[model samples]
Target: MMSEALRIAETFPGYSREDWAAMVEKALKGQPISRLTTKTVDGTEISPIFERAVGKAPLAMRPQDTTWAVCQRMDHPDAAKANDQVLNDLMNGVNMISIAFAGSAAARGFGLAAEKDVLAKALNEVLMDLIAFRLEAGAAGDAAAKAFSDVVADKGADAASVKVSFGLDPIGCFASTGALPADWAATLVSTIKDLKAKGFKGPFITVDARPYHDAGATDAQELGAVLATIVAYWRALEDAGFEASEALGMIDVVLCVEADQFASLAKMRAMRHLWALLLESAGVDFLPLTIHAESSWAMMTRLDPYVNILRETTACFAAGVGGADSVCIVPHTIALGLPTSHDRRISRNLQTMLLEESNLYRVTDPAAGSGYVESLTEETGSIAWALFQQVEKAGGAVEALKKGLLVDAIAKSNEVRGKLVATRRAALTGASAFPNIDEKDVEVEAVAPIALAVPAAGESCTPLKAMRVSEPYEALRAAAKAAGNPPIFFANMGRIADFTARATWTKNFFEAGGIRSLSDKGYNEAAEAVADFKASGASIAAIVGPDGLYEEKGADFAKALKEAGAKMVYIAGRPKDIMEALSAAGVDSFAFESCDVLAELIKIHDVLGIAPVAKAEA
Candidate 1:
């Protein structure tokens, strides 16, 4: 007897790739097939369709079982408070804790003090053997690790049962802060030897690519950095009396997961594939790769912060489905201040829902065997491998940083990303597009100021700057919020049905800059709109209507609004043919799709006598 899938397959003859292309071209109505393609920042081309081909190998596979640790970040400055939060998280669904030490690159501006007394107090009530612990202590990782070991000893837990990662990435610290505190060789050897002597049988070194990612490196660049950093660690460990396999077993990789779901998934798979290839080339047996993914800090925004929940949820889902061994979801309000207890709960529950309700982790390599994912994984891995070769030729990751090669590449990518954000090519829901002007400000607990570490004065290089794509738009919105009262007025030119769409668009556009827009209902006469515009007391007025109506009454309405004391007049639609006449009648500008929204908002702020505050440089 034939099964259902077998019968269905036999009922249809498979078409060739060319046959599929022909059908797609016909459906496109003579448009070129290339129009359906998109180019990513990493120089990879994504096509609308993909076909299975011979000799295309599958990427590395994840564990078959549905298991991934729900890791939560603990960075409260007070030891007791941090301990309380850790217990609460453990009592909930969280199974892993990542402690950020003060002055670590991963700490950003928040972490617990890295002292023995503080470490003991922070782990007082927690059972070290039951839950996994990962430390992000940057250059101070060795000290933090010793302190953590002391805490475990005090609790009398068997050291063999403890699972932890002493996240020690000296090269990462150098890239982040632009200074190497001590001799890299001495530090690496001493840290590893101390851990081995203490029977610490966990990942001791972290090859963190998050510094590069936060500094605006594309996916390929970030992967290249990770590979290069890992290779450097392997060489250092071998020199310090460890074999290649042992060194590889003692290291782990950390990657940043953002809101792009498919890209994030493919990136994780590509990293594993690249690692396998690297191990094969080094003549070492393959080992399962350990990857830790954290929600992207560069994607979080201070304005309309509630939208960050959606972003974090998507990132967490990607990390889980991408086969990350563990995932951390940063609080939605992290960019503003210390996250409140409620915000922490929201962040933890986001991963819980995705794991328990959505069952995202139930599938092993869910994207495998799909033509699109397979192609993406291959192309992404190839690009990263090539970049790794370039770094190797320039004398490894540290030398590449010292020579400013990696810094220059990251800067170029950052510039391109900034331009995209400015033009709204990269949309930020609450910060750059569709912002709520009347939304109340979010309150958060007060956070302590960062205590910066003093560098020990070795070789120094240019630091990679961390940036948020929405920061520019956020600055403009901040200015508008402080400018007081309604900032703009909408001059509806026709019946409700005629002007509603464009009027709504105009209102949303201005509101994205945090400018309150007072919209009037449909008005028949130019005199009525002019009267309403003057009564609203808004200096900036937008003319909203249909194309036919704009051609009919746009000129008169613009002239009347200027005469009635509107400092600046803007038309919602871009009627190119009548633009000359409209401008002559005092329509200063037009706002439409694909226009430079950030530039327009800045101009509007200038005209309204609102000066934006100086933004902090990334």
Candidate 2:
């Protein structure tokens, strides 16, 4: 087969970058190819095309065709209920479990309290030796780890037979909550000592990127933060009297996987590659780093939450193909409340199908040598390393955060990102974009939270808060829904061909905010549009048509709507030439692509007398 393929390959001529560029420019018709470039928040430009990658080695974590651990998160507050969930998931082919303790970010307000009794019940019938284990305990990490280790011993599970990530991440906890329970170095040393005495060979430290990622840090920022955090722990452990190789083995990583498949895939690959580079630069031997990816909390939507299913699937594929040791799919309904078993089942099945049915694990480092992914990996790593250097210059993750250097970077990125979401530049399907106004309420297991005592403040910086992209849009939708689904009169002014495109877009715009667009098919006369607007009884109105029609009748239509008692008149598609005339004729705003859609929606809501809806915090 190889000889025959090589014989055939010799018959064809190859294309060069110059040839590709000529074609691209011709297709662009005098427009610069730079117009196709997109940028990350860190200002890394991603080109639309690239030549074949050269001299790049594969960075896969596992061997070819090897399946990764299927980790189901155990987070129900009730111990008995959580036990059922764990056993159910395990019985159905899940090979790993991530235990989220109360007060952890992954728990999302509901997790088992780190008590021996609760731990015992949660793992009642499950054999610890049979499955992989992970722990997520924020500032209360020591207590949570101690409690879990003790429970395993009490059940007589041999420590050597079990594979567990202790997941004590003080830097990550402090970065998210702005407080460490104690001196992080002291805490890590004590925790390691206590666990070592119990015969537990450990991946004791975790450098989790979710805190920063959830706080709206871009991929480069999150990767940079993780790199700095891991360096901090490696040094701290060496200082506390561990061998360099042993200290390296004690660390693991967790990164958030969102809907951006190429970025997430590149991020995972870059993480492993970067880790190797970091360790080698410090004169340490390279080890294959263990990475765990969870679907992004920042991308989930409370409204039309099922879209998260699609988002998480794309995320899981990226995580798997990009060489994560394990991937956990956050339930689609998670943003709504505590997920039911059905929700959990759907997530598990989604992952199972990806692995078993879709065969995503059939190839290791699937993105290796691909031009776009390799370019992204290289650029992402280079940008991330520079940021890591910046954090190190500020002393470390803890000190950098304390100085608000990293925090300020996070804030700036978040501001730019928030503007993107508001302007519809970042289209959130089923949330900010094509939203379903009548989506049914999702079900969640109704359970009272296991309230846990928060640790007293150790040191404080400004805490990074988790934010969802759909939040502001959700608030607008909620307000509109509460006001009995307020109507927006569409004073469409043109023939069918002139108005159809803008009218369709205009309808979707208003409906995205839960406002019904009351529009006729087409009305050539201002009198007919005004008559329909007055009969529709909408306080806010929008005029939708082509530029030619807007140039002719736009101002006259705006004047008619205002005279018909429309509180605000909006013109769809900006006709810049007639803007002054429309404004004088009472056109309050212009709605167009890349405009501040959220702000315009809010303004319309104000005219409708709908009170501002307070957003629910994550």
Candidate 3:
């Protein structure tokens, strides 16, 4: 093949790195180039531009190929329905299925029964030898694993040929549930020994990252946690008389992908690097480790679930592009309740389109050679390895969790990110930004939510509960619905054109906290606006206009709205040196970009006498 330089176009002007920097400085009006750079949660510095590299190497995939399993989640409570969905998915496009049992972290609150007869029914008429089963059971890991083993044994299938990931993750279970059936180290060793002895040639044990990831672990922390978990498990398995090669072969790696496509892709690829590094340090050959991904449940939103489809598509595509071996595309409506069959089909179709239509699985290591992504992978791996060493020094993931090191880290990071979410700094499209107050409800099945009990086995720690980014804002929206969508008067200070932009922004801004915007842009006089504000029946009001208009009539409008029985008054835009005057004239607060939106909304709820809505989902 001819190189690009060899066939260069003679008329095109070439630019060097210095030329680009000079141009950027001029564009920034003498500002430093560092202003264009940002940092990730792991403290990796990200530049706005990158130069082409002379030499780079591609990271190898598990099988040096791009084909991945189109896996769907099957969590219907009825065994017959689960079986029917499985058959339908297989018939349509899915070749793999994940069975999330009741009380498991995977399904949130709905899942199948963990019994042999029910398990058999769930697999009725399906060929075990052809289809792969990924288990999504938590704390009930023992019973669910044994029941599936019984299904494999009694169904006359060749256990050696059946593809199953039992997904017995005791460390992950303990992290989530805070209780293990017994001492976790011994339980895991005995369970592995028992499963291997049962003649199930398996990728039986998993280092599931969902618990820590959902609990708000950063990307580097997640990769580090995965590395630490794999090391801990292999050490235990080797001590239990399993060969290094055999132990490595028995392990499956699970991760979560979110809407941040580039970061998610880099995180997935970084896991592979961490896995290979672990093997190299152990003096074992690189083994095939199946990386299964579930699109992050913590990233899904109940308020605008159709937006969740967009999130799931981007996230699932990243998983495929980063060469995941299998992926479970969580239904868009799962956060609401048990998803309908149609909803399940929509999720399956999304994955199928990504694979067959978009051909995302056709290119192996799609992110391997790009300078930015390669550097991202390196930085992510380095920081993750550093954190993994810290975990090892603290006696690995289990000990770190017991001593509260990991949980504390999660707390500190989540607290920082929570402030971001609370303000408009971290804009959530449907919930905290431009929300759809009139969005019709998306229907979900009317199944009762399940509460799975995890029996205490004398060992316990503080559990890491899962959370979503949009929960706080969504709760306010739910409360607004209960309060009958009370209106907030938008007291536009000047003529329509002068106040349109700020008023529109104010409308979007206030509605984010579930308060509807009752805006009248044509008001030419403060007295007329006050009369309208009184007649509009809104208890609160915001004065919005251009800076000049705000300096002119903003204080008068605030005073008028308050005098017209508005419980609280606000003005948009932090115009310089006039906030004291506005506040004295009855402006209670200010609303602008990067303000504490959740806090302000909660205050609005209190002023409106609306009760706080409890957290609705489990």
Candidate 4:
């Protein structure tokens, strides 16, 4: 049967039986497989060999000890309430705060308020005292930088404890801005030096590869861009008078985490190994890289917003298990408009719940044992390392960037991926798979855009684009809650040859409703079997082998079953004459392999309100 199935599948061209067999073989080998069959990042043949030995090394970090934070970007229009939300989040277990400041306007609600003194004062009052503040790339703008300096200057070198990131890449900024300032490199070098001098250890000079990933670049392209960029940073810092080790020490790396669990997991592990090698090659001991991941903004969709919860959960879990030091979940409604306080809370809680409940962080290097994961990790590391070497040969990362080689590589990868997405080969659930036209009806707080306007003392201003209420996942949770726990049951049968297959099918049907299935051995008395089913609350029953028993006691047994008040009796392969004779016995149906038997059984169940006990047909 299996061979025939394979042959038909190979010839059908509709579905590959080889694919199915590969998956089945994998399942047989012990690793659980999802029903969906999608290609891995490397575009290699599918195999199911998972490693069970990779977790030997204690992971440097664990999510169980530290939960990912639920941070809202406080670029809101109002600085103070953005501050208020920060305090609220901290009080509710949100431990990290990240701010994105492009200018005075961007920093206003972040407490910059266009006045360096006031901004510093507000930041110290809100974030310094309440939560860990993560400074985004633009947060290092002259005004914002000075504001940060003032806040930490008083604290001196101990200011290292204050978390901050400078998304400093003159090239990245130039790419976004469409032109590089003549002194951009000078400014980045100076920023790193100044921040280091002020005792900011691990002050991030981002190798922001998210843009490539978001743009649909393959894993290799994304890693390549980052390697190239890191080389640029290394050279930039060394030229600015920092020793190689000091320069390497002055910066930390950040990578994006995606929903593809194994790919994301392998990518992170491979990255760590690569960073260690890179630092070794540069003759510097590698430092602990700090990766703060946000749910990919690019993957969110405007359609079928509810499915975003599933996406975010998967992404957040990936980020945490990928060993991210911190993670921020984007609200499901992000693509719709400005996020509300509730949206932020939900996003935060998503991380909170997963860490606390799922226990994903208890074990370190969770992907270590899987054959697929290890192989993929090695493959990614090799590809990325070769690319890094190539970049060094091409006058380094900056030159590669300037020549658009990295961009072109990403473009080619994106083109391949775009084709996959278009063909539904890469499923984006809400956007491409099952679209929802009805707007989600959750009551969520509306968030305005970040407002940097300074309000008069004691006055308040809302963030830009802030308004309304929306709760995208609330409805889903409510529905799930309402459904409650399903019931459980057991199936009992009387005969094997006569009713084995039918009993198995019936058991599966009932089990779908959470019922269990058990069959009576041949020695069990009919009455005893019925009694067992009754005791187990198995309201449904099947009587089997009446035809074979008829020469001896079939008639008497049917009469006894009727007298015993068996509600539904199924007679297996009863002769026509015997069935007629037994018609008055109230048998519900006579079962046989007519190919249509399964369908007929379904119809009977539907009409009789018989909820099957199992989810699958035996």
TM-score of each: 0.94, 0.96, 0.96, 0.63
Instruction: Look at candidate 1 and tell me the lDDT of residue 224.
Output: 94
**Model 1 misplacement above 4 A:** 1-30, 52-61, 451-454, 614-618
lDDT of 4 by residue, 50-134 (tens): 4344544534654446655556566443556566666677777677776666342222223234345545544544545335566
**Model 1 quality (TM-score):** 0.94
Top candidate by lDDT: 2
lDDT of 4: 0.56
Clashing pairs in 1: none
**Compared with the true structure, what per-residue lDDT tens digits does model 2 show for residues 1-618?**
477757866788877877777788889997777789988767778887787788877765887778988999999988999999999999997999999998887688788988889999999999999999999988678888888888889989998778899999888888877876657698789999889888888788988999899899989899999999998998899899989889989999999999999999999999988998998899887777899999999999998888899999999999999888898998998777789999999999998999989999988787888999998888899989999999999998888999998889989998898888988889999877887887787788886554433456677888888788788888888888888889888877767888887888888788788898886668889999888887887888899988888888888888888888888889998888889988999999898999998888887887778897776543
Instruction: State the C-alpha lDDT per candidate.
Output: 0.85, 0.87, 0.85, 0.56
lDDT of 4 at 600: 39
Give residue 229's error in model 2 in angstroms: 1.2
Q: Which ten residues in a row have the lowest lDDT in candidate 3?
A: 53-62
Residue 1 lDDT in candidate 1: 79
User: Higher lDDT: candidate 1 or 2?
Assistant: 2
CA deviation > 4 Å runs, candidate 2? 1-14, 448-453
**Error at 227, model 3, angstroms:** 1.4
